[model samples]
Target: MTNDRRVIVHPDKPALASSVAARFLTKVVDLLDERPVVHIVLTGGSIANAVLEQVAQSSARDTIDWQRIHLWWGDERWVPLGDAERNEGQAHAALIDAIDIPEANVHAMPASDGGLTLDEAAEAYARELALHAPEGADTPVFDITFLGVGPDGHIASLFPHRSGIQVTDATVIPVRNSPKPPPERLSLTRPVLNASDRIWLVLAGADKASALGLALAGASRDEVPVAGIKGRRRTVFFVDREAAAEVPERLISPDY
Candidate 1:
């Protein structure tokens, strides 16, 4: 594992979500204390949704100024606005709607019903990022990004050996022929995701154990896209015991 990485294991899925939620809340509050606004990227999956639900139930959630918390999706299914498969939709139903977050601060990707082509939607999302990016940065320096690792080690829509993983110039790209269901999607490229100050990969279930192990063992990013993901300041993996089953002892933190 890389020197900047940390592995935190919880006894179960619920505990993993709760622990991550606590850390997430504290991180947001600390960032807001230093600035008026903080940008965050959200991911989708059972684990990610659970974390959002936990965040919604956090007692300290009131400490955050929801209006100053800008939300962005790390990747999104190219379906209609309210489709259950869409990450933004899941996030909204799980947490966003329960908070006082301003509508303008919620930057959801364009859906198929928006009358734009897949490439067009991807380009539009990239334009949105460029507009909100801090001065002199190609992409917004997200305060923290939450990602979920597929059982196959895919992160976002960047699946193993896929062309999407090779994209470096574009901030976001349209994904076609994805190995997973609902093949059509939009995802931020590696460079864009790696621009974040911190990254948290949330994983659970024994199905994810092997992939997580290979990723942390320094596998090729092209073969294991999640392996390439690292935050400028910190990269962390929050896994339940089931997911951590195959992780190397050296990568696992003794006290985390």
Candidate 2:
């Protein structure tokens, strides 16, 4: 794997969502030609949800085998199963609900109402990940990992300057007293996220311009978490023009 990095700038939020969604579908179709199963780590954010909605509506979605695609979250708020604030819930409404995938294929993190404490849920998800791990690996090899970058440069639940950002001992880490809402969350550690074959980091808005610039400029991982992510094969920053303010013209790729 080359560990290649690229910047894809779209015209606006809608363009970013639709382009990424179409790319996702085509990638899945191509992967199915090489393997029987494909695991994708998904993230949450308005832009991410928009992309999922695009995936749901695109007729091109029917080109791949839905059952072979396993959806995993990069991080999840420890809210109840169907809570409106839960990432899984948003994903369900945006894409999963309209698809014919099996319940077993959707690997959602535990809910607070599921009788498991936050720590318990984290450990349980870790065990589940290990169960699906390849023979010599501790975590499953994700084919494509979709992540949404926060305006502050956070990826998943790993906020800048947070202690959780340094944790590599666990595949899934429990985040507490988070700067973002809901306070508690379960997130796949950076190693897991970085281990994916392809990483798609997306952002949309002027608020994200600073973070996006720092990330592409190779800022400190502790200060800008998104900067640390590097996929085994390809790592791409998919941003709308508003968020691409500081991106170098040379890095602005015209196509994938």
The whole-model lDDT of each prediction reads 0.92, 0.91
Give per-model TM-scores: 0.97, 0.98
The regions of model 2 sitting more than 4 angstroms off are 1-3
Q: Which residues of candidate 1, in runs, are more than 4 Å off?
A: none
Model 2 has an lDDT value of 0.91
Clashes of 2: 0
What is candidate 2's TM-score against the reference? 0.98
